[model samples]
Target chain A: MSSPPRDAPGAGVLRAAFAVARKELGESFRDRQTLLYTFVLPLCMYPAMFWIMVQGVLVVQGQKQARDVTVGVVATAETAEAARGQLALDEEGRGRIEVVALDPETPRDADAIAELIEGEEADALLFLPDGRSEDDPAALFFDSTSSQSETARGRVVSALEGWTEELRAEAAEARELDPEVLEPILIQTRKINPSKDDGALVLSLLLPILLVVMCVLGAFFPAVDLTAGEKERQTAETTLLLPIPRLGLHLGKIFAVCATSMIAATLNLLALGLSAGHLLGQLAGLGDGAPKVELPLGALISIAPLAALFAFFVSAVLTGVASLAASFKEGQALLGPVQMLFMLPAMATNLPGMELTATTAWIPVVNVSLAFRGLLVGSASAGPLLLCAFSLTVAALFAIWFSVRLLSSEEVSLSSETISMTRILRILRPR
Target chain B: MTDPTNTSAIRAEGLAKTFHDPQRGVVEAVKGVDLDCRKGEIFGLLGPNGAGKTTTLRMLSTILAPTAGRALIDGVDVAEDPLEVRRRLGFLSGSTGLYPRLTGRETLRYFGRLHGLEGERLEAAIARAFDAFDLHAFGDGRCEALSTGQKQRVSIARAVLHDPPVLILDEPTTGLDIMASSDMIQFIESRREAGTCVLFSTHILSEAERLCDRIGIVYDGRMLAAGSLDELRAMTGKEWLEEIFRELVQRADAGEGAA
Candidate 1:
């Protein structure tokens, strides 16, 4: 690394690097399809898709909340009408329950009730015993797989308890028995720490998943262009002869790939935010009164770094892997499973009650989701945030080093299509 | 640095490059080749494909380090300091690529800047290259849009933009039409007359015969013969270089058969 004389005739390595970099950027931007893939499509697709899904989910939720539920009534004594009246009283107490009468002689089978729950014909089923005594046993059937069914069961039980209390109070007043004898233990609950916002909770989780998809998608095109595209065009051979250092060329291209991915992630984030806000505003307008969900600027700020770092790491690693794959087609084939690997973690982040511990923070795509959740809810610890960032940076550097090493080797740079194991063995042979 | 007025532009001695395949043992690309090229001279390295001509050129340009021996460009050790050697030489080859996305003008300007040319000087160089190469007709055309010969001309322009004392061309006219080839041959002779030391490799005997002051016949990574065209003719006792080459290769093949 000694200093060389100025005014020398040959070009400097920095100049060669810039020449190559400028050319790559210009070519990439000039292609109409590339521009769309890099910027326009990401901006359009993310929000449009997310908005549709969210709105669909909210509609289903609204319907569930409003749906009326059915309960069963069984005659136990000679006063079948009186028993029906008691069931009516139960329904009235629950306020939203609709009671369906059943024959007492039918034995009120639990299997029939379970079938009703499974078929979705009933949100829940009730089995009443053939007795008027307050001590008579009763049963409720619910589908554990259905949250709505479970909730309906809970509502029915609470209404029955309310009816029993009213009846006992009336009997005590009439017979002059002590009202305190019927009292039992009561439980009450109040949330001490309210979550920041429902939207924040949902969006944060959603954003991480979006980031993982964006990172993987963002790496795709640049990796193709840098490796296979160059090879197909016969540009790689010329590139090898450049006076610039090998590492410089690799880094310059890697930087472009990282930048490409970051642009995509940013566009995706913006599109999602705008579309989500529009959907929320519409829902609130519908009288459901869902609160306006603004992307909190602080949360947005926190997400920016996480998204950028994740994208950089993904692009770097993918570019390295792409370089080794021999061709664009092979690279795509190789990355198909890799894409699945990345997407699964993102999908796992959306599973209800999934918690993020330190271990989760180190696993590539999953960690980004966990960090997003923490940042959005205003509970993100700085330690974990920094740790995830450091891990991503290290991964990116590793990828860059691997790619550089590949680019530096004569065997890799000079590789042709239809490579044979013998030829590879020949290259690997010691001189 | 050597005395600029007295020293040859390039001096290479006993250059060798060996490729060792894990399964095949060793394949030598170049073997013990020595060369001296003075200013205002065109030295040709004539050989078949895979005969180590490109490898020798790569070593001399500092793109490949010699497995054995050393080289000096104007007295700076190329193996020790390639960056220094790079600044002293201009290189072009059939495989040298043009950035297809960039216009010819932009390509030249970009490369000029890389060589630390800027402001008026850079502009002047770009303008001179365009005019001298007749690149003005399509200077604004993107490289991908240019015809193959046009791209070749642009590649040559990029190489000489900095006007180094030494020029290296590896099959620079392999795919060009006759007109383009003649233009290129003239350009190389002019560059030499302007005091640039030139070394070109080609499989075409006619090109080397017409343009080179001294020609080195390389085969199987070894220099089979080296001398001026007349000296080579006298030594081989053949009037035509093609006849001499055929005879020599036939002899080599016969020797191998006997072995």
Candidate 2:
């Protein structure tokens, strides 16, 4: 077999870099488990996990709606009968309380009545006289800490409303006054909460954390494989022997990890979509009716840039840190801190009152988290979000430059010998 | 300065490297080494561990920069133009490995591309390597699955994929069985026949004796001697190569000049 002339070789830096990236992507997908981690897990696992969670919450809520609470009356038997009769008039069962009578001769001791509630004999105790005129209404008391007690109080209020209506009617007949004149004004209100409001709070809490965390996680394995894995396999020097620049080599590796990250995150987004159906199904139990839980399409589309930028940001960091280690296990250990670095900032976004402020927009991982959350909620301002993007770009550039510098130097890359601090300082200080 | 002609495939003069370890202060890894290997010849560097055999090869292959002095690869200065030096060179070591996730064929293609070979030419080059190394049967298998000998062949194939004029192999047979070692010797001889200079290090004395057109004995990061087998024996006044090697190491350890 004859060999070709050595005078010329095909393609240059960009092409070579891409070749390296292609090889990495191909190799990653070939291993079934790696592919699963990269694609399948995010697509299937999160949805199933979220479905189970939603089911659990719905069951607990359903039990609460059907619960019955006992109401203990501190008044005489006739007073309790009047309240029961008033409650019985309403057929909707809006009053979910069971009535129990007390002795009329007993002192109206609020403390003794409270004892019944404290001892768990009754959920709540109501205090009222056996008889009272329309102008002198009975007073009612119940424990606030217990949900049962709270429910009983609501039922007592409903019963009082009925007695008040009858007294007003009698007074209106005697005076020959219009019955509607008793109420001079009407009040109306609107609320935006999880039950009646859209799932804005959940969206705010989950979006950015998932975006940043999944982006980091997506880059994790690929970054490790390319850096420390190369060394452990004894292929680092061999790979570097090519004519391509160290920059090309690093860019190739960073590109591959970033691509994997985006792929993983996008799959994670799809998983979020699948699990969203179940999440919305639980909202229906609120009886306020929930529109389908649609992740703002704009937010989903915007993630492409944020996820890519984030992938670029963290992949460079992960690769550079991974390169510091000599083996896969050691790399994994070293990267524990790197993962924490990303996670802490992302988790900070979930804190209430934490917003995309001017200062926070320049805070790397934290900025991306805030900006991403804002984007999802359609509340992120353009100025701060762009600033956050710029900050991430700078960070990504620095990490890649650092990685390339480490890779380029013969003292470090060749024998896996790290430069001594004094040597590095000498280069830095340049005395 | 050992080059006798302009066609020297490798040349070196006073190559020096010193590493600073805090506890040990200055650790001189290589001290002013000078040597040369002519085209179509095999040069063997024989020494024990930490004797600078690897350090010297790394310098010549442009993997490490010299603290002082310089070397040339097939006429390209290693220090002044390291990329040019790397282009004309094929480097391998006992520690160097093939990608376990890639097949032998893919390994050849990747290195070929890195070396700037592509298209039909790259295919031809890979095919030539597969045929020359007799690696067809194991070409499709991932590198990790191949036997040690097969892996070694693929490693060598990848190294010379660009048809470099110079080959630098450090302890090429450090962990090979007898069969694999012989196969490596045959491959090295073939490269010499093809007019490519082969510089290698080995622990196997008989194989070195059989393969080297000339041998350089390095000890304590210094070149103690360089000559043909008969010439080495004559200089040391020893009957056997091992005796000469032992005498040289002892002399170097004793901090004495050549006898």
i-RMS, every candidate?
5.8, 3.6
Clash pairs, candidate 1, are: A11-B115, A15-B114, A429-B21, A429-B22
lDDT, residue A204, model 2: 58
TM-score of each model, in listed order: 0.80, 0.86
For model 1, the stretches where C-alpha displacement exceeds 4 angstroms are A1-23, A31-34, A55-126, A130-196, A280-292, A303-312, A337-369, A389-393, A417-431, B2-7, B20-25, B254-259
Q: Per-residue lDDT for A11-123 in model 2, tens only?
A: 35576578778888887776665577778788777777777877887776666655676766666667678766665454452436677776655455678767877888777
Candidate 2 displacement at residue A244 in angstroms: 1.3
Candidate 1 chain A: worst 10 consecutive residues by lDDT?
Answer: A1-10
DockQ of each: 0.26, 0.48
Candidate 1 lDDT tens digits, A1-431: 11233653333445454556565667777666567777877776656666787688777666665666665555454434443454444333233556666556545566876776676666766656654547756666677777767667777777667667777898788888777666665567854443337667657766777777877777677776777667766677556545556566776677677777777767776677667666756654444445456666687787788787787678777776666556768767766787788789888987877655677777877788788878877777888888888777776677666666655566555555534446545544555
- Model 2, position A258, has a per-residue lDDT of 83
Residue pairs in candidate 2 whose N, alpha carbon or C atoms collide under 3 angstroms: A9-B116, A10-B116
True contacts kept of 2: 0.49
Candidate 2 global lDDT: 0.77
